[model samples]
Target chain A: MDHKILQTARELIEEAGYPALTVDQVAVRAGVGKAAIYRRYASKAEMAFAATMHGQWPPPLTDAGSLYEDLLALARAFHVRMATPTARQVAPALISELAGNPDLDAQFQNTFLAAEHAALAEIIERAVGRGELAGPIDPTIAHLLLLGSLAAGLYIINLTVDDTMITELATAAAAGIAALADRHHSGNPQGATQPQ
Target chain B: MDHKILQTARELIEEAGYPALTVDQVAVRAGVGKAAIYRRYASKAEMAFAATMHGQWPPPLTDAGSLYEDLLALARAFHVRMATPTARQVAPALISELAGNPDLDAQFQNTFLAAEHAALAEIIERAVGRGELAGPIDPTIAHLLLLGSLAAGLYIINLTVDDTMITELATAAAAGIAALADRHHSGNPQGATQPQ
Candidate 1:
């Protein structure tokens, strides 16, 4: 029942701006009573966070021995996540909310930011442990590069409901990120740190 | 004179959204007569496109010997260009307009889209000429990854507005792109194109 409410809330927010969502509207959409929502979330922040995490943040990248392979897969998954029409309708509002709300900001930092960094970090640790990457490369910097590419791929269609371009964007990003990881693994003087 | 009006119009739009800008407001901003704006841009699109180009596309990347070096310079230039706080305020509205207006979209394609691609292509050409990249890496794909990372970096910072994080984000993107390009140059056979 709570899961149904969350999905309904996400749909309402996705259709209307985040600022415009009402618990009443969410309940109506979910076909549940308002009390059900209050039981779960005290305020819109919790509701929106639930909705956003539901909407954003594709799952973690598994640690395939080939870091490039893993990173590329993550990119593909990221694109698939964004391919939803709701992503287009709500992206602008999401940007505004993320920019303005400290609570949401912290939530994002904890959930999306930390998760993304962790996935990339896992790949790096594996590579470094196996002597795949050079000593000079920093995992933090590598994670930033890989995750940055994935994030960029998300907005390629930007607010356009049309997602036909996502596959190309994802494929390119995954390949590019993977290629970089592979090169760094092959003893490049500098890996995705400061351009050669 | 008309060109000057169009340019001024964009600044006005950036300062105040398109809905807010009046012919008189544009004239005042541009230091031109209202008739001049009327003379050139029958509507807002004519004017907004020019102002956006001011920062949308910086000058093209001149061929520096190596793709990495050329892109480093280009990426940094882009960082400074989008760093304008005002761009964030105005970008979404303009992008929103793109969906509704074909003329504006074409202008965007010509100005912002074409210039970035042209510049990236130049870098790729240099790499190919130098035999730095292997037989064939789709230039379009390479272009998207590089631009996507750069775009994503700015969009994330702008949306998140975490001023402290930009430098690291920018650095990571540049490094990642360089690594990606290097792999394109080297051509790895273990590439995973599509996943089941």
Candidate 2:
């Protein structure tokens, strides 16, 4: 079944790494014919993408009615995703491997990065609609600020991202976005927080 | 002699990555005996660490007398270090390799992460002294915000980190820090900017 193959693939990725994941090995583990897998996916990249999409993808965020709460939701969701054993094991390797494998890179961007960007963009748009933000903020930059801070704490510094850290990061990010929107909308820094 | 060995090691890392870099290859490229490299460094990781330290370390930041300017200097400095061809080539691999390699992780923390943390800490301390900040802010959180934003912009998005982005990130970080400190000092959000 499709579910069995995806589950088996996820286990293989968690146990070894993406480089060690192969179609034959996955088929053998899943007790499915290699032909069945090939029928579903064109390559290892596609299979891994499908497995990841099915297994560990974060659910889409709903608006929390406040920019701070909305950013917190997204940040917490990202933390949950990155904190997965599979994600922790696979992500660094995937990033390294992506340099040489353009196909994998494109697949990751299309499936993961693009979706993440869209979700964050929606959050920012909702904030703007509620007049919490001055106007549409650059979601890419917003994404960088929110997720980037979490990445540094989790990946670079090897810190445990507890509730306190998440709250602080989310609050600061919301403040930063507000300040940026203020600066962008009005050239003068003083007019940043005033009514439009 | 030492310079040549380090240069060769850097070239190897840039060309074929750290796994392919061996002391023997470094000696051959640098026209030094294998024993010479062994005499200088006990392991390939040590040699790579030294080469990175000698080659592309960011300069220590002097206070520019303002939090915004100081952070901008640090952020810009970080951008320059990351933008190097060798850094672009080796960083992702290095991050992946660090998980399995304790010695490399230690060296990275001691030499690079610690120094960057100290520099940002100094900037925050200076800001406090000038009353630009209410009091000392958490340097770890501050460093995460600044470098995290840069890393996201550079590594993940694969976007060029221009001066504008750097400035905005720095300003937002400063504001974030102020907001955090205010929240820490006073439970209420309204008193954050009013007093300091």
Candidate 3:
């Protein structure tokens, strides 16, 4: 029943939009009673939220063992998702809607953004503890800049719902992060590559 | 005349919505003849496009000498616009309506996405041509990752507005990019730097 509701909600959002969305319409479309819909979801907003996330295809996250590999994992997941057209379409509307509705904003945060940050930050924090990063480095800023470069990857490359987009973003992002860390650690640009 | 018309259109949009937008209301609010508006714009949709974009703040691009610095400039400008409470109020509705309407869609894409991407792509293209980046990098995916990462940053960081948001994003982005480059070219896990 929950799956039915989610599937129905996804169809509605893909066809129409958030403003035009209605719970009664969802119930009818799902072949369920209004009471059934209400019993599962408190409101159309709730249902919409679930439906929006229904078909998310997160890329394979590889454990490269090194901090760079870990970071690359995050970037790769982002690249694959951004490159996929289906994911690209409705996901943006969610962000645009973030400023208006606190619940939706919170949902996006709790479910997605915070987790990725935590994963990356934890890796960096561990590196700091191990004296891998410089003593003066800020974990907060590290997360910010790391994520920022990933953002830059989007504007520089056009994600046309294809594999080339994926490889290009992933490789470039990997290159960009490697360059940044090398600079941060060693004053010498040439010193960026030490024997692993 | 354009200013007055835009201000009035904004008021109407805020008070009502995209659904309620009409030239008749804009004329009455601006104390201008409807013919005056039609003289400049082909339709109400066009007028609405201008009104909504009246405050659109695209990135202030610059050749910061390096990919990292250039990326920072873009993020900082975007941050300024998004940091204001106005970003919260105006951008949400504007994006919503733009996504919903094809006419407004053209305006939004041209003014915001296309222009910004052009600025960012110039930097990436320069890097690729210079052989700093590997050949055949997809500019599209790169842009999406950049923008999507920023969108992701807003939720993850415990910040208030777009400036802090973009600033953080830019720095982390630089770091990530630098890190990736280091891994690919130098085999260094840390201490990568750019050749000045």
Candidate 4:
């Protein structure tokens, strides 16, 4: 029953858009009563966010050994999730909506952004443990390089981050992180790559 | 006259939002006739895009000698433009609106994206000529790294891309580009930094 409502919501979002979606329309199409939807979701925005992002939460973190492979895995997972009709069409509009509403933005940061940040922290930690990264690079900055670039490529230019693009992006990001860590430790550019 | 109209439009967008902004309100505020606005802009979207982006268009690119300095200059310029009240508030919603409209998206690509791309191409060419890069890296990819990440950082998290952030990002991006070029030249990772 819950699956049916969520799927119906996804269909409506794909057909129309995040802005056009409403509780009434969702209730009607899902063949469920308004009470049913309200019981499941607090508001139209919540419903829309869930329908677009339900199964894709926590961002599919991987235990891949190296920073490059780990970032690649995360990037690929992000691409797969974002390439969905629902996510691609809905996310930009949803994010735009977030600009006006502080409550919604907080909700988003708490739910989606928090999870993704946690996943990234774990990846960075694993990389440090393996000596692949000299120490922890800023997770927020790291997140920007890896996932932020992928999101921008898709949202801004409609350019899909393909395997080649992903490989290049992940490699560059890993290299960038290494360089940053090196700079932080020694303060000299020349000593960036030497053994600690 | 055009400046007054654009400023009024920007103020309306900042106060209410992209959707709530009307040509009527802009005219009243600017103390100009409706005909005056229509003469300058085709529609409300155009006016808003222009008002939010009038002087910032063609993205201030610089030839600061090396790729790292050049990229840092570009990054700082982008930060200044996007950090404005109007651009920060309006851009996300405007981009969201672009999803449903093809002609508007094309206009955006032609007006903003194209100029930015051309500027980046010039920068990449300079890097190649100076032997800072082995060969030209993908301009689209480079744009994503330098500008896209900055956009995401601001739009998503409201985190301003400060000097510290820009410095770290520029360093990483430069390293990333070099690593990519090296990989392209020779398959071996060790050969990435050797004199060409």
Q: Which candidate tops lDDT? A: 4
After superposition, which runs of candidate 2 have C-alpha atoms over 4 Å from their true positions?
Answer: A13-24, A32-56, A187-196, B11-23, B32-56, B187-196
The digit string of per-residue lDDT tens for model 2 on B1-196 reads: 9889998898888888765778889988899999988887766756776776434455867778677778888888888777665565456566556655566677678777878788888888887887766677677788888887787565544556788888788878877887777777666754342221
Range of the 10 consecutive residues with the lowest summed lDDT in candidate 4 chain A:
A187-196
lDDT of 4 by residue, A1-52 (tens): 7888888888887778766888898878878999999887766756776777
Q: Which predicted model would earn the best DockQ?
A: 4
2 versus 3: better TM-score goes to = 2
lDDT of each structure? 0.55, 0.73, 0.55, 0.77
State which candidate has the highest TM-score: 4
Consecutive 10-residue window with the lowest summed lDDT within model 3 chain A: A151-160
Q: Candidate 3 or 4, higher lDDT?
A: 4
Q: What CA root-mean-square deviation does each model show from the true structure?
A: 6.2, 4.4, 6.9, 4.0
Model 1 lDDT per residue over B1-196, tens place: 7666766676676666655666787788668887767565545544554555454466766775665566666766765665455555445445445534566666667667767767777776676677655443444444445555555544443443233334444334333344444444445532233342
Candidate 1 deviant stretches above 4 angstroms: A1-4, A10-24, A30-61, A96-106, A135-144, A157-196, B1-24, B27-49, B52-56, B92-106, B159-188, B191-196
Reproduced native contacts, each prediction: 0.24, 0.47, 0.30, 0.62
Q: Using TM-score as the measure, what is the rank order of every candidate, best first? A: 4, 2, 1, 3
Better of 2 and 4 by TM-score: 4
Tens-digit lDDT string for candidate 2 (A129-157): 98887877677778788887787566545
Docking class of 1: acceptable
For residues B1-196, write the lDDT of model 3, one tens digit per residue.
Answer: 9889988987887777655678898999899999999886656656765666445546456566665556667666655554344434554445444445666566556666677667667877665565554432333444544554554344323246445445434544544444444444564534243211
Model 4 stretches with alpha carbons more than 4 Å out: A1-4, A14-20, A31-46, A187-196, B1-4, B11-20, B29-45, B54-56, B187-196
- The per-residue C-alpha lDDT of model 3 at residue B106 equals 63
In candidate 2, residue B131 scores what lDDT? 76
